[model samples]
Target chain A: MSNARRIIVINPNSTPEVTSAMRDALDDRFLCLDIPEGPATIVTDRDVAEAGPRVAALAAAQEAPLAVIVACFSDPGVAETRAAVPCPVIGIQEAGVAAALALAPRFGIIALSELPIARHRVRLERMGMLERLADEVGLSGVSAYAAGHDPAVYDELLAAGRRLIASGAGAIVLGCGGFGPRRAVLQAALGVPIVDPVLAAAGVALSVTGGQR
Target chain B: MSNARRIIVINPNSTPEVTSAMRDALDDRFLCLDIPEGPATIVTDRDVAEAGPRVAALAAAQEAPLAVIVACFSDPGVAETRAAVPCPVIGIQEAGVAAALALAPRFGIIALSELPIARHRVRLERMGMLERLADEVGLSGVSAYAAGHDPAVYDELLAAGRRLIASGAGAIVLGCGGFGPRRAVLQAALGVPIVDPVLAAAGVALSVTGGQR
Candidate 1:
């Protein structure tokens, strides 16, 4: 029997491509796991409203001490997960925002869409970083999850980062899971800290959860 | 023998006036126990550098799963107290930032001194609200642990809030323990959402600690 503790990373979306990308990005970071990796559940419902409770239920059913990561950029189920779990539970939005602040005095969030960008701005305000923000810019026509499997998704994200920096952003936050797979590439291209909310979120999950696996 | 859980709010400064002010402010909020009130502790250390760990050791000595609030504006021993207790440990800085974000899209922090203001800005960055700030203004020469008793201190704080609002702040955050004694007065004076970091921090400790009291 392997001794590695199980850690669950929940992708609050129905998309397999996004989940696959997240798995690949995080897999190398956990090479020391002695056992098979835990399940990565993708919510079939693309609806944001239903995502929280479903993910929370999944966490509740897993009988033992389990560290859970809500992989969505919106951090669906994060508050409920914290209330339900005995161990540490983290939301990507929470972890990502916290980590970005650690690296840069200010950061600009680059959301997948204009509508969500406003919502994200509210979210940041709720978190109390409004002054820390130089600005928040949205990618006008693209949504990370809606991009399907097109390689052009990556290019759009890279372009968005450049635009935010041009507007005087000290750091670029990859505001969605679809961008998780391209962190290093975008960071190199942007010449500034490209905050893959996923990586930062996951790193914090590891710290708070003490998830050795 | 009271079944109610006892929570100690340690002001971390030896000012009875601040302690009484904090007590009066919280008088109606917490449930009336057998004691009918929360216990308060104040640090005798008038010195800054010696305060942090000294207060931590005091919090470490409690026998029960007691919730302790390091009431100092600087949150002198919060991290060390968390290390010493299995229950929830909260810092006023962390709680205030988190709570203020819950209410407003942006808030300005009014601190005592420029050095302490820098420290608070760092804390907000750590809390992920660096970007949500409208401003961080300091009272010309007020000190966190020593300013609570002086009426002139309130004048400086009020001035700071005015300047913050002039710079486009939608809310105000009182960023020190010495300022806790004046939360209500400041809140009314500013006519904005004035977040008293002490109360915000205490509420978080209560939520996470699952206080039986």
Candidate 2:
């Protein structure tokens, strides 16, 4: 059997919705691990990256196999976390990308702001997936919950999607956490695949970890 | 700004190559979290989906915040994990689909085997992303490494990809860990966006959890 003794989930953002959404996404998938008594935890501090080392140090004291997930879109302490922990560490973005590649040949990214394109590019390169990226389209200075505030964001999303599809992208990844609820509307309009990182990461984690407890 | 203290990464399979690839994918670009110190760990072994909850229970003991990632494709312990931990947990497949939706409009999942199609579909449903799916094409009964073991398998992959694309798939995902090294080659032939789950998951993880640790 797999020996993942413990897991820690860190939400870098202060927003409870994102954290809760992430939590809800993984609810009830690993029933077997519970019967055997496994462990999992969630951290809600926006400052996890800098403090990550201290956390890892504490987790190491448990003397069991552990896995850590940087739960924010920014993945602050991923490297430091890796260096601090002897076991493997993963970020949801990394896990999401890996899982996406497993299912799709090409994919696109939807961002909340236009400026993050550079950041997204850098991320793809770091992950060695630049070549596979068809495009990175921004939602044009909107918050994750922009759709709720402005119904027009949906139209903007659709228009942006057309541009990405024209650019030869086959799949779309919703960059903002707020877009999760809009997936159905967008997917129907785009008539293509749309990926929400939260959901994608949750699924891949389950598969790779195989419902560890 | 975030206060997550720990994170866990669980790998469902025993293969070291997969683990190494996962590690390499997140080697750099962890600074998204905006924190300097982060902690992480990787778990290997354990099969079937039952092992996740046991692992998560162990993480709940820490006083700090935590994030958990299931590194396998099946998303083994997500359900139990959520119940076990007070923090958020993510899976690679879940993260992957989210990222893919951001980039592509329609994506096809070219998986390693047919047996997992139903499971993959179920995962898609859980994420509320079933509509984004164009197709779930299996690679004609092949293991991830089978392509490398024999050239014929590579040809089969190519053939499967072509069929998927023709069937209205705009992008592809490399569904297995064995396909890690072949992403570039597949992209070259497909001329469309492809989602590498590992890469996507890592990137999204970094973005969500805060980058550059």
Best by TM-score: 1
Candidate 1 per-residue C-alpha lDDT over B58-165 given as tens digits, one digit per residue, 9 for 90 to 100: 666665544566666566666677677654455666656654554345668877666576666666666566787889886776554445667878788888889988
Candidate 2 error regions (>4 Å): A1-213, B1-7, B28-47, B54-66, B144-152
Q: Indicate the worst ten consecutive residues by lDDT in candidate 2 chain B.
A: B31-40
i-RMSD of model 1 (Å, 1 decimal): 13.7
TM-score of the B chain in model 1?
0.79
What DockQ does candidate 2 have relative to the true complex? Answer: 0.03
**Residue lDDT tens for model 2, A70-174:** 554544456666566554345655555544453345667777667667766776676556676788887767754463235888888888888888888766777
Tens digit per residue, CA lDDT, model 2, B1-213: 244454455555555555555554444322112001111211222333344554455445444434455555666666676567654455667665655554344567777667777888986775556676778877666643353344777787788788878877756766664455565577667765555665555544333333212
What are the per-model DockQ values?
0.05, 0.03
Q: Can you write out model 1's per-residue Cα lDDT over A1-213, one digit (the tens) per residue?
A: 135555567776665667766666664332211111222322223345577787788777765543576777776677787677765565666555554443345567776666566666666666656666766666655545443345777777777777777777766666776676566666656666565666654543332222212
What's the distance in Å from true for residue A150, model 2? 21
Per-prediction backbone clash count: 18, 211
The DockQ-based CAPRI class assigned to model 2 is incorrect
